[model samples]
Every structure is written in C-alpha cells, then in structure tokens.
Target: MSTCRTGTGPLTAAELEDWYAVPLGRADGTWVRAGLVTSLDGRAAGPDGLSGSLNRGSAGDHAVFDHLRRWADVVVVGAGTVRDEGYGPLPAVPLVVVSRSGDVPARLRRAAESGTRDGPAVVVLDGHGEDVDPGRVLTEVASRGWRRVLLEGGPQLLGTWLEADAVDELCATVRPVLVGGDGPLLVPRSTSLRAPVGSTTHLLAWEGDVLVRTRLR
Candidate 1:
C-alpha cells in the first residue's frame, strides 16, 4: 500500500494521479466507485456548498477529474448536490440525476441543457415509488448508450449505493487538515463488501495527502 501525507496547503497533479489512477481500474463495465476528498475530521462539506476548502489539489487532481468524466459514459449525482453545487454536464458524457422525486431544480435543467446541447436528460430513481417512474428513467439512460456509470455524490447517495451493494470501488483522498465539525463523513455507516476487498495507498510527492483506493475483491 502506497500512502502520502501532506501538511502543505493543497494537492498537486502528481498527487492526484497517484490517488486516482488505480481506482480507475476497479470499475468494470457496469459500475465505478465513488471518489471524494474529506477532512481529517470527517467533514465532506464546509459551511457553504462549495468544496473549495477540500479542492486544494494540484492541477493533477483537475486532470484526474476530467479523465474520470471522460472514462464514464454517464455521471451520476444526487439532485440535492446538483442544486447545491450548480453542476453542469461534461462535454461528452451524459449527466444522470438520481432523484427519488421528480422535482429537479430549473438551474440544473438549464445548465445541463446549455452544456449538453439537447439539455441534460434527467433520470429519477424512484426507490420510494412516489410520483416518479423508475422503469422509464432506467430506459432513457440506457438509450443514451451509457453502460458504465460513475456516481459522484454527497453522503446520502453514497450510503444508498453502499447499502445496495451497487458500488464497485471507493477512492478517497484524505487531506491532512483537521476541520472538526459535525459535517459529514465519506461513508455514512459501516459497510461490508460482497466478497474480497482490496486497497492500495499512494504517497503523493508534493502534497503530503494520501490517496486510498479500495476495490471489491
């Protein structure tokens, strides 16, 4: 296991590659693991919606994010995150919104539309069977030819996937900052993998942050 610890301000490209490259292999054709950066105190969010505090990575992290987006046919995010972060669609990848309810904020719709030409296609995951249709949502997303999907999430979404055993890998970038707040942890609760679980650590050269990559064994 390779581990890097950073006491400096943020992360660099080398650090990002060291963190993200191996987890990229964990995702088979069907699923990809969710990746996130969290404070040592286990806060995924700051007071505000922006993760800028956690975004202190070198150019490499940005490049890694871009690569992940490119490799993923569909990028999945919870609706709340889309509203809070004001997320937009990637150039070529399709954006899949997992909303139990059909209430999608107009800004996301507009952003997805303007960014992706035909607007973003919304997929509401009706786990509750409320007013939405899960069948139609799955069908529409499948129609776009997105076989492999990546879920970039807030805690709740991550928890849901973990409970369902739908996650294939989990890549986490643990920064050295200790922002002790009752914010949120990377994983909501304890989860057991289906069978084998393997992990590797990469020590970043510049930043002392460690990237831990875990896959289903």
Candidate 2:
C-alpha cells in the first residue's frame, strides 16, 4: 500500500492489515458494514453520477477501497447501484444482491451465467412484491457462512437496511470535493433510521479522504 501517497505515504502492509482487520468493530454473530464515499457537500457522487468518480485522480482512495473489499466475505448491494455503476464480478467473494423487480444487472448477470475468469458467484435475493427483507438477506449471507459482509449501496438500499437494524457498522469516505446537486446523500433523506442518530466517529484519514467508522445507536 506504499503507492497510496498523499496524506500518509509508504504505509506498511502490516499497518493496513491491522487497521482494517477489525474495521467493523466487535461482532456478536455477523459483521455487516456499508462502505461508501461522499463529497464535502455531502453528495455521494459527482455530476458523473457514480461514486467511482470520487476517486478519479487519486489512487489512494482506491487502494483503501480495494483493501476493504479483499477483507469482505461477500458484497451486498442494491440493484440501482449495480445498474448505475455497472457492477462486474467480484474476484473471490459472492455478491448478495437486493433487487426490486428481480432484475440483476446485465453485466453481472452475464458474468455469473457465462462462467468466465470474472468468477461465477451472484445471488439476487427475491425482492419482489414488497421491499426486500434486510434481515432475510443478511440471513442468506450468513447461511453461506459469510461472516464479514461488505455492503456497497445506492443510498436507498443503505437507508432500508439501516432501518431494519441489519447493519452492524458503517464505513464512509468523505472526499475533498463539493459536488453540488440533488445527488444522493450518504443516506437518502426520504428514508429515516428507526430513531435519531448522532455524529459519526472518526476512524482515520488517508490521502485526501476521511474514513469514519461507526455503529448505529
């Protein structure tokens, strides 16, 4: 992780390992966390309409992002994010999908079906009729023996899961830009937590992004 040059340079592999090792905090049974990036203006993405755009010039954010992904057992995400970001196959971990119309994104669906080097592992939870049950989705992930679940979201999905109390922790990256728009917030304003939440606890800052690690109260 030496190339992460910016805020902290030449970081040791042992340091990153120790930092992200217990990132999700203490886990009673299952460890679930959402990893998303936001700008200073609180927009989750820029005009490009993708969070990946947040780390366009800086590879530092990407290095940390990839590190977190590598530590995850499975990635949980919403269908909208899959469509918007054009999700592909995850290397080793399976994807636990949450879709409304049971529509898996074309790119991911094809990768799972074709069975290429992209790796074939995609599980779209039946999110038809009503909203997808967050507990049920977590249960499915747990059933697969996935202890560390990394949730990548598109606001709405995060809000729902947060409301459901299925989320164990949140890892958000605050970028240095002020992407102004009606762009998505870290959590959609339309959805609220079951109760009022407070400020997020600061974990660490790397490069130009601020990392916040907190559990729902």
- Scored by TM-score, the top model is 2
lDDT of 1: 0.58
TM-score of each: 0.70, 0.85
Mind giving the per-residue lDDT tens digits that candidate 2 earns over 16-55?
A: 6665556434454577778888888888887888988876
Where is model 2 more than 4 Å wrong at Cα? 1-10, 23-28, 110-117, 198-201
Specify the poorest-scoring 10-residue window by lDDT in model 1: 129-138
lDDT string for model 1 (26-77, tens) is 2333555576766677767654545555756534344445656766767778
Model 1, position 45, has a per-residue lDDT of 64
RMSD of each: 5.3, 4.9
Candidate 2 root-mean-square deviation in Å: 4.9
Q: List the residue pairs that clash in candidate 2.
A: none
